[model samples]
Target: MHGPAESGWLLAALCAGTGAYCLLRMRSGVEEQRRTAGGEALMGFGMAAMAVPAAVFAPPAWAWGGYAALFGAVALRALWAARTGAHHLHHLVGALAMVYMAVVMAGTPAGGHAHGTGIPLLTDGLLLYFAGYVLLAGARLVPVPAVAGASGAKGWGDRPELARACRLSMGIAMVAMLLTM
Candidate 1:
């Protein structure tokens, strides 16, 4: 991400922390929750790496290709997994977004983002998607009568709010990273 070293570091930390939490969530009793957490963990960690300040450590040109390839594979996996549930569709979108950003970065010259795309349609569309996701996810966080959870001792994997918060954080991180692009 092309930005102040301080802000980039902060973003990286935020993402890394989210990744760590997602890893913990993978110990969930529910198979679906564990599966979802694993995907979120990947996204969180990948975002953290990409958010690293260029001023601190700019990756070599080839590294961008590596990022693209890794995310591309992830996108494919998410696509296949999407058949099982709608959450996987969200994962598919997130993975594709990462791939898009990786390709964009690969095209950017080292030391500066001067060659960055000038607000292309892809970027705009992604911004709309993540922004809308953030809004919808944020709204879901507020407990309402219809969507309220049942009262009882909830296991870590069964905690919908935490999972939603995880997604919300990723959505915010995505929006921030997109803005920098």
Candidate 2:
């Protein structure tokens, strides 16, 4: 059986692993556009790490602070993305949860077990939202015939296969995180 600490670590690993995979896929996309989504995904993993450990072993202040910072950053990024018309439904949900977590954490006291009622709900919601978004991303893929590259480079541009893999892994990771939370 896994302890709470182990669960937390697992959640963090899932987030980090999926985010890294997505980053790699994004790197191979057309024009090699930087995937801020991957960065956000990694940030989520970081937040999960901090929140879970704090909930299990640390004081409320530490837990709440970690949650607050994570959500605060996400909220800001979401707002910027929304304003730029680059927002996706998944990002919007993630942003909302982050903002909510930040506010809740800000209001609660530190070092208390009785005050973590909202954590589970937040985790579940985030999981579903992110998972849904990952599916949507996969469904939206318009395959490119060949991977673009220079001088017969092994790695080429726009690998839809990679993107699909990234999405699947990310979805599974999010599901795992939610269960652990």
Candidate 3:
């Protein structure tokens, strides 16, 4: 498998740029934008962390464990907030995925493949999931005809489009990372 050296850096730049844009939105003094921007910022930073080269700053086992725990907590919080919207459910899933990746990496030897055995099921499943997520999310970002008084009439914060873009980016980043595995 090819190393992630190149793709990782590109993903990092994308995530950082998205995070900066979200931060700018957060400063716009809109409550809904602020809330959405907060989640986007977290996702962007988290993905950036995952995209970094291990040689540059490999975290210790404890750090990985901490990451798993932290994301687990975030997942739990998202679950608790599910009544707010479907986005919360997506957040929970994303956070849980992060936890899974962190725990798996923590258990694996340094510079070793977490799925080195070439397990078709796990590898193919991840590939399909991320690929579908990226496609669906990207499609949703496309502007379409909206019914009058529909939810689509709202601003960026009211809609999940920006958040979807962030998720799509993360999905692409994860797919790249998985390919390198």
Candidate 3 lDDT by residue in tens digits, 1-181: 1245666678778878777767766754577568767776776777677767675667677977887888888888888878888867867767776776776678777666565533456666777777888888888889877668775455544445665676677777767756654
Cα lDDT tens digits for candidate 1, 1-181: 7788898899899899999989989988988889889989999999999999998899999998998899999999999998888988889999999988888888787867623463578888989999999999999999866546757677766778888998999999999899877
lDDT of 2 by residue, 1-181 (tens): 0126666567656666666655554555454234554555565465445445545555445555666676667666666666656544455555556555555545544543224445666676677777776677766665656546634443422544555555556555545534533
Off by over 4 Å in 1: 145-151
Q: How good is model 3 by TM-score?
A: 0.77
Q: How many backbone clashes does candidate 1 have?
A: 0
Q: Relative to the unseen true structure, what is the C-alpha lDDT of residue 54 in candidate 2, on a scale of 0 to 100?
A: 48
Q: Could you tell me the lDDT of residue 105 within candidate 3?
A: 75
Runs in model 3 with CA error above 4 Å? Answer: 28-30, 117-126, 145-164
Candidate 3 residue 104 Cα shift, in angstroms, is 0.8
- Quick one: ranking by lDDT, best first? 1, 3, 2
RMSD of 2: 5.4
Please, what is the TM-score per model?
Answer: 0.92, 0.56, 0.77
Number of the predicted model whose lDDT against the real structure is largest: 1
